[model samples]
Target: MVIATGTLLLALPVASETGQPVKIVDALFTATSATCVTGLITVDTPTTYSLFGEIVIMALIQTGGLGFMTLSTLVALLLGKRITLKERLVMQEALNQLTVEGVVRLSRYVLFFTFLTEGLGALLLGLRFSRDMPPGQAFYFGVFHAVSAFCNAGFSLFSANLMDYRGDLLVNLVITALIILGGLGFSVVADVYTKRSWQRLSLHSKIVIRTTMWLIIIGTLMFLALEYTNSKSLAPLPLGEKVLASYFQAVTPRTAGFNTLNIGDLRPVTLLLIIILMFIGASPGSTGGGIKTSTFTTIAVAVWSIIQGKCDIEIFGRRLPRGTVLKALAVASVSLLLVVTVTGIMLVTEQEEMEIILFEVVSAFGTVGLSAGLTPQLTVAGKLLITATMYSGRVGPLTLAFAIAQRLGRQGIKHYPEEGVIIG
Candidate 1:
């Protein structure tokens, strides 16, 4: 519904710079990308859209990043309306919480943390941007980027994204911080905020934090090593700038999408590594999207358990539930199927290289938004395909599957004699 509304708004003549109604296909693509918080664009954002259009995009980003239910809950709170059990359950589902208990309270924390973090980010970015432009323009850029960064929506007023600010320490630090915080999942942030110690945090929080930290660290080092001598990417910069750029690149592919380095210029190995990171994107209940870090980690541990001939998957001193492991595998399987199916279809429909097509497909599925300069050149078929991919990524493949399954009605499980088929 939000995407539909945004599409209509963006299709208006006032939305374009030339006072012409944008093509329905382009408008739908932009609306889906914005609402999904995916940075893919069919047209140049700054050049194609007027202030009204930009504002509409920004609003969609905000609305999409934080799910609509969260915003509706905020409205209810402001109206002094009590959150009933049904609303709590909806909030639980929306926030990906395990239970409805304390979901309303969590909603409060989500809003508070969102505004507080974005405000500080805006202030810091505004200060840094003021040096490059007039105060008003700088402030506008700051606020826009801050919200975009915090929401993990990679929309930029500048055509080059953050490439121009690649070496600027302040911009890199502030934007990466916002991306990391936003990608951490609000539950993890809330856990850290309330617990204030690692030992006291929930297992989910612990896993997410550990997985995120290790990903960033390993991704940064690998990018630095692989692109160290590649003239197109990290090679031309000084050591410090190289590391900085590598770090920013590492951080962005985790569903953040703000690239300080040229994504298309990176080596194939680096791109493959980034594709892996993008596939295992931010945690649940966060602005960003993917199969999720937790799901990825769970799958990894499950594989380890299988290799070790263990029946149960254990992590962080606790055995994972059978259902939890199954769900993780289910989500990963569904996500992989989606990516593979889309890439296969695109290969037949479009003329892009296999690697480029795969990257675009994964980026769309992950909602990571980093394109290899192929977005603008995509055919109408490609655009619609990616638009659908973005929406599915945002809503989650498992959720979509479950919705379909529910509509098919419940089936009773039959007790059958168990037999082993074969082992691979």
Candidate 2:
């Protein structure tokens, strides 16, 4: 519904650069990108969109970021409407929570913290943006970027996308912090809000925070090491700029989508690393999308347990349910299948290089908008393929699988014995 409305609004003449009706396809693509919080674009946002159109896109980004149900719940709360049991269940599904308990309060926290975070980020960025543009324009730029970064939407009014400010430590750090906070997931945010002690944090929250920190550190180090001598990438930059750009590179690929350097100029190995990061994108119930950090860790821990000859996986001193292990495997399998199928289709329809094809596929499936500058040149079929991939990424492959799968009758009378089927 959000995408559809955005499409309609964007197709109007008021949204276009020349006061002409925009192409439906382009408008639909942009709307999907914004609503999916995917940054893929066929048209440059700042140049093609009027102020009203820009506002519409920002609204879509926020709506998509908070989620439709969350917004609805917030509205109902504001209006003093009693939330029913059914509404609570829907909120659970929307937020990917394990239970309905405290959902209303969580929803409240989600909205409150979201606005508060974005407001503070905007103020910090506005101070920086004011150095370049007029006060009003600077403030608008700050607000747009704050929402975009916090939402992990990656939409930027600048055609160059922070490349001009690549060396600005303040801008780099602020955006990085917003992206990390947004991608860490609301559950973690609320956990920190209600409980300040790491030991008191839930296992899930602890895992998320720890994993996020490790990823950032590892990614930053890997990027710096790999691109240290790449003339088109890091070699030309000053020491400070290179470090900052590398840090930004690490944070952005965790599904934030902003870029301080030329994505196309990165080393092939660096691109492969980004693909891995994109596939493991943001934590559960976060504005960002991917298979999720929890899913990835669950799979990893399960494998390590098997290698250790343990019958069950353990984390943070608690046994992880067997069902969770199965679910993690299911999510990983489905995600791989989706990426493979979409990449195959794109390979057939597009003439881009393998790196471009792979990068775009992972980017779409992860809802990470960073591209190798291939999005604008996509054929109609390629665009449609990517559009579907973005929607799937945001909804999650496992969730989409459940939506399409049919329940089957169980074989009650028959019994089968477990047997070893394969060896590595």
Candidate 3:
């Protein structure tokens, strides 16, 4: 569904002011980048694409961020049609619903919650934007950015992204709010809305909430402390501005590409911190992509258990299932391998600094979109590689692997014994 939608959008006829056709490769690349929410672009989006093209791209980003199934389900509900059991099952899987019976209700809630939060975010952003832009343009910019931030789509009309508004408290707060809500998995958000308390939350919600808070707090402090004296970026800012910038940067890296400062100017330690946050990405069943906060938490718990010589992994005073722990480890391992391989390929194909290339590659694979200014100079091969990385990041490496596994195997009763080799 994603590939088809992206391809069709790319194939749509777009022309310059003189009626010349836009290059097909550029269209394809941009379509893939936006639909996958990777944010790597060969050409500057605001300058290269016509207004119509920009709208089309934005629509695609929203659709892709909200899964095709979810959008179709909403349309079905709007048309007053009853969804079938089979359809509900698919929707349940697509939205990662806990059960099949509540699929319709869950879908409705998801849609409502998404729009409500986005609307509020847009209003706040628009109020701030009016200080610099006309009311009409400000409103549109606010709506566009709200949608983009919540979707984790990373598409921006501003050439420098949110850097110009770094010190604007209203803009920073609005964008950060959108990013946080988007990064929290839909399931967690739904739980919050329905339950309204930490005690009443599901185990998944508990894990996501704790993991997200920890990452943000630790990440912000690390960036601030590491980059405080770096002359290129953070040093010159006033203390208050530096704190705001640090927090914004910390929040943006978790699978939302909007930047408040020059990424290329960041100190190495800050870059490393950002990379870690990007690798963690957003939670499951959300607009953002990564191994997910729950997965990260599960892995951490498992590691802690092993280090403490305990057998079972426990968190929030509850023991996680063995299968869950294993799955988390598997996803993390696969994601790491994908990032390393893609980074190596980019190094060979693009003559850029190691930090920049690594940042680009990891950002692409994590769907974080925090580039170090190396995106525009990528070769054709490099672009294609990134396109693939973005797709995998969005769909998930483990999910794709499972799809391939199903094709290669039937029900199997045979098992191979596992063996341990070397210690770390």
Model 1: runs farther than 4 Å from truth?
A: 398-414
Q: What is candidate 1's TM-score against the reference?
A: 0.97
Residue-pair clashes, model 1: 0
Worst 10 residues of 2 by lDDT: 401-410
Q: What is the lDDT of residue 119 in candidate 3?
A: 93
Q: What are the C-alpha RMSDs, in order, of all predicted structures?
A: 2.0, 2.0, 2.6
Global lDDT scores for all candidate models: 0.90, 0.90, 0.82
- Stretch of 10 with least lDDT, candidate 1: 401-410
| lDDT tens digits, residue span 1-424, model 1 | 9989999999999999999899999999999998999888989999999889998999999999888999999999999999999989888888988778999899999999999999999999999999999999888889889988989888999999999999999999999999999999999999998999988999999999999999999999998999999999878899999999989989988787888877888777888998999999898889998999999999999999999999889999999987677778788888899999989999988998888988988998898899987888898889989999999898875485345433445555886788998889
Looking at model 3, residue 64 earns an lDDT score of 74
What number of clashing residue pairs does each candidate have, in the order they appear? 0, 0, 0
lDDT of 1 at 350: 90
**Where is model 2 more than 4 Å wrong at Cα?**
398-415
Looking at model 3, the pairs that clash are none
lDDT digits (tens) for residues 231-258 of candidate 3:
9888999999999999999888888899
